[model samples]
Target: MRRTTAAIAIIAISVPTVPLTYGRSQVGGARVKQYQEHLRTVLPEADHFVSKGGEYPHFRGYIRGTAGEVDKLVGLAYLNSDVGHAITGYASEIVVMVGLRPVGTITAVTVVTHNEPYGYRSIDLARFKNQFPNRR
Candidate 1:
């Protein structure tokens, strides 16, 4: 009886630990390293010149455009069926807003809005908000 209990405890502990060890080796470490290198390469060129204070740090002088200029602004699409299943009821569509300063410099990112049924109440305006003073 004692041996069985010991074995059960050992299995419980090892099961969670296996993911911590194997998962890190598989992709987590490599993904983190890649992101760090990517961020290092992109930070210098992006300009942040917002003087107005707010809940979050203002990232101004990034992309120059207005709210209606959705087509002109770059869009990043994450088309993962698994993510679709997890968040929304159907695996049809998912739109997440991410704040981008330049090609590589991402200052702040928040989920603006989603077509999903149940999620955040109000969209975060900051995600799509950009102040570009130099654009024509």
Candidate 2:
């Protein structure tokens, strides 16, 4: 048997609305719920989130952190980030495939992905991520 899963992130981008492929409305409620549960785990400071669209032509999600203790907002987007290696030569063709792409606020500097060697923990602690959130 084959298994499949869906992820959702509440992002704040001004791009035009995109369509979702898994059907709209209550049809994929289960997957949305699942995404919410997992997002809560990854972003415990988040109070709640809102998602846009239902399929992949331009599916996106977003959440705000207003619990006082949390200082960042979250969004879902699909990105084709270039990946490089310490020993291997840098190549633009080497792209990081993201399954669940999480980026911080409007000007947010944080991002999350499932690529190896990208080092999520270290990246999270990097100084660059501390930049001010986008106010747009």
Candidate 3:
């Protein structure tokens, strides 16, 4: 009985300790839909937009679309978890890959204010603006 009680207590204690991770779905299906809607509004001429599973952290999806930009491609992604936590308020390095090559990069990543954690200070947008231009 003691062992069972101790086990339950241990599990309860560890539950909250486990970090929360957000994926494309974690952002909420409605939010993802909203983002897609916003993207469509911003890039109305896009040929098409597709979403796929991401490879790291809390990344939920990899969005690809074609607009009138030089590269004609843009990506939208979401991160949730410790990896997300680290980059929550800052823009981290993002490499945009083209057919077997990296084409452009986004620098000074900043978290969208709506996604910011409660009680934490706001991050400077200028601090996380684009830093990398086109790189081979």
Candidate that would win on TM-score:
3
TM-score of each: 0.23, 0.28, 0.34
lDDT of each: 0.34, 0.36, 0.38
lDDT of 3 by residue, 20-109 (tens): 333334334444454454334333444444444445422122334348534344443333332333332334432221111123332113
Rank order (by lDDT, best first): 3, 2, 1
CA shift of 34, model 3, Å: 3.2
Query: Model 3: which residue pairs collide?
Result: 24-60, 90-109, 91-109, 91-110, 108-128
* Model 2 C-alpha lDDT per residue in residues 1-136, reported as the tens digit of each score: 1222222222323223544322243223444553554444333445554444433322234455457764344544322331223222122122221223353433233333333244443333346444433433
Off by over 4 Å in 3: 1-22, 26-32, 37-47, 54-85, 88-104, 107-110, 114-122, 132-136
Q: What TM-score should be assigned to candidate 1?
A: 0.23
Error of 3 at 74 (Å): 5.2
Flag clash pairs in model 1: none
lDDT of 3: 0.38
lDDT (Cα, tens digit) per residue for candidate 1, span 97-123: 223443544443333225534445543
Greater-lDDT candidate between 2 and 3: 3
Q: Can you tell me which runs of candidate 1 are displaced by over 4 Å?
A: 20-82, 86-136
Clashing residue pairs in all predictions, respectively, total 0, 13, 5
- Residue-level lDDT for 50 in candidate 2: 43
